[model samples]
Target: MKKPLDSEVFSSMLDASISYWRQQGKKGVWIKLPLELSNLVEAATKAGFRYHHAEPDYLMLVRWIPNNTPDVLPANASHRVSIGAFVMNSKREVLVVQEKYGRFSGIGLWKLPTGAVDEGEDICTAATREVKEETGIDTDFVEVLAFRQGHKSFFQKSDLFFICMLQPRSFDIQKQASEIEAAQWMPIDEYAAQPLVGGNELVNLITKVCLARFGGTYNGFSPQLTTSASGKQTFLYFNGHFP
Candidate 1:
């Protein structure tokens, strides 16, 4: 809808539209106002519209018309998903990288190849992709070893980090020059003994879990192909190895 020069006109039109929608049994109403039309926000609230979300350039307002039912609108995205690859070779060497940035930078801490999952990308695929991008090592996704959830980590948003097990298909390390300071195959024992890994409780536990998987004493969540209710094929991750 176009922004009106007069707030009184916008209010009248909004009221009329709401009444018409209610008469037609419409349950939900959304109004998006551009920054230039912010003057209409007060008019919208006066008409019972509440804030749904906002961006730098716009504001979204919502209202529910049905008195018998409750509002069921979903909120904006609350969590950012990331993936870390734990790749161990037959010789007990793990693929590790030292990032040029982030908390572990300049500390000489060799950590797993990790990156944020892209939109519409599977977690398993993300793990392999991060490994390939950071180290130039080809790998096959195995299973998710574990996951860590932390609040207010990035931009005041919650974080979900999935630790995935990957099998190496190539051994050469060509570290990403832009982001990685170094990448190599470090021995599992040495990787686990890192001061940074041992200092952080969650990282230490994750390292142990990776070791357990390597020792064949622990099984991680594996993905199985399945069809969703919408007739879309997707992967459902779980301990499907169990009987």
Candidate 2:
């Protein structure tokens, strides 16, 4: 059910659903809960549902009716989330980096610094870390400029791509020895005309979108990780990250 009513209504609905699905003798049912419906989420869980995979905005909860079946999630639901930085310098040049090894290792396709988000990493923080790792350029993340998801590219595995706009603070391009071949601040037009950057439809559009959204302000949000003397890591989102 889409965002259900209040908890009482949802409880009645869940009761009816359980009665009906039990009569049908089917395998299972899935409750897709938007992140906003934490109350309903709790209600569902209290009704014997369990956690499943999650998307950027939605949470999936599942319950198996079959006595023998393990709760099987959608096979394609496992998507890896990643971040890319579109860093622009005061000179109007964007930070581009060449990977030491990848699909575009030697093809000379300079891309916006991109990397995988760690298990507990914050999105904007990941973007800034990726930029610093790939190009040795320190940046303050502005905001998420654009996102693209596709299964066409990677062995039918879905990928979530967050392209962010960042302000360049430090300029030296000390490329990471292991992963980066080289890094440079290239003129926007010059960067776009290149093969990989220009040829890929999603990449091209996100770059354009980032450039278009550059001047306009965006209130950036990132999770704050704090460590105490006891050696524990705590993750907290900006509560109201985006204004």
Candidate 3:
């Protein structure tokens, strides 16, 4: 005789199924089961679960666990939110800018075009806008590469770095007079030799990985500091531009 599905057994099966879907990269669970399992479905729903499909034979369920961790911000040194872009060119040369003002000023360092993500602004949007403003080159593709957290700061801070591919024949570049002092293209090996702004180790790691995969020119430069409206300190760095 076949074994019947009990509450404990059903719940365990559901948990395993959810885990399997997540490992496969699905965002949420969508399931269809025999209508005979109505009692089981009711029990699950009563347990803080919800379903999607309308068909009686199929059930869709979602059980969300909230993330209680506080979002990190930069000025708080207690928390920070920053975004970076790796802009590369076809000639194996990356675009880099020299910092004309703030913290690591006048130091010849190379980095991606990056900046603090403003409150209420999407990270990718902020990155694209910052790149255009800093290097006068608009990007065509913005692929998120990695996210990292700083270990030493009293405030929690995170960096969102992206791989931005530039448009062909779009190198008519100019620096923002108020933020960047100079902008130009240089070979990847040469650009890597300069000191990085913001003294970041995470940025360096992202650069190494990108170089190994794409094998193209890298770009961007050290971040410059600017005072926020709330009187907090923030830094901006650009990796490279896509267009």
Candidate 4:
């Protein structure tokens, strides 16, 4: 819908459309409202509309007419969040482990230590836990270096991964025998030169980026804060956009 809606008549106009859609045997109705028109959107909500999703430019509102309709919003719409530890020691060697299971199993593809984030888990803390579990090394998360998303993750669930830059506090590699075939502190140059990584164009590119940002030279991504007019705490940044 257009911006600067006629708020005075929008409620009536929306109600009339809903009534028409119901009489015409329409199963559902979707109304796209621009992000600025919160008042008009609230009017539609009282008229029995529910949210589907929100993109940067607009918000999606869906209305299901049928009483027997299944949920319009998916129950499992959430993506699985995981963290990867890009741990480095004093010698600038990165911690990597060979997978004994999962997608890259038995292929000798070295990857940073990673695992699924448990419920109520702090992302930074989870990074260290995964490193300990896989490599038997104590590490401290310094900052988030990068992140990636996979739309077609296993079982068709979406995946969100955080690549954390960590400082290795303790040494002595002990690979988790079950899931990890071997773990080691490979020199960054040697790790990047591996055939499995170097031959793969994308992996090699990412390895270079990680190596470039190694150490605290590329640190500090802390979110800025702000106070609302109503004396409430609010995030200054939303979905990568500054308000």
Please list the residue runs of candidate 2 whose C-alpha ends up more than 4 Å from where it truly belongs after superposition: 1-77, 152-156, 217-243
Q: Candidate 4 residues 103-194, lDDT tens each?
A: 88888778888899887776777888999999999987666666788888866778998777778889999889889989998888888888
Sort the candidates on TM-score, descending order: 1, 4, 2, 3
User: Ten consecutive residues with minimal summed lDDT in candidate 4?
Assistant: 233-242
Residue-wise C-alpha lDDT for candidate 3, range 156-189, written one tens digit per residue: 3344334543332478897899988888877887
Candidate 4 regions with alpha-carbon error over 4 angstroms: 1-71, 215-217, 220-243
Question: What tens digits encode model 1's per-residue C-alpha lDDT throughout 19-55?
Answer: 9999999998998899988999999999999998888
Q: What is the lDDT of residue 183 in candidate 2?
A: 87
The better-scoring model by TM-score among 2 and 4 is 4
Task: Indicate which candidate wins on TM-score.
Answer: 1
Error of 4 at 83 (Å): 1.8
For each candidate, give its TM-score against the true structure. Answer: 0.83, 0.60, 0.49, 0.61
- By summed lDDT, the worst window of 10 consecutive residues in model 2 runs over 214-223
lDDT of each: 0.90, 0.79, 0.61, 0.78
RMSD of model 2 against the true structure? 12.7
Who is ahead in lDDT, 1 or 2? 1
- Displacement of residue 22 (Cα, Å) in model 1 is 3.9
Question: How many clashes in each candidate?
Answer: 0, 0, 33, 0
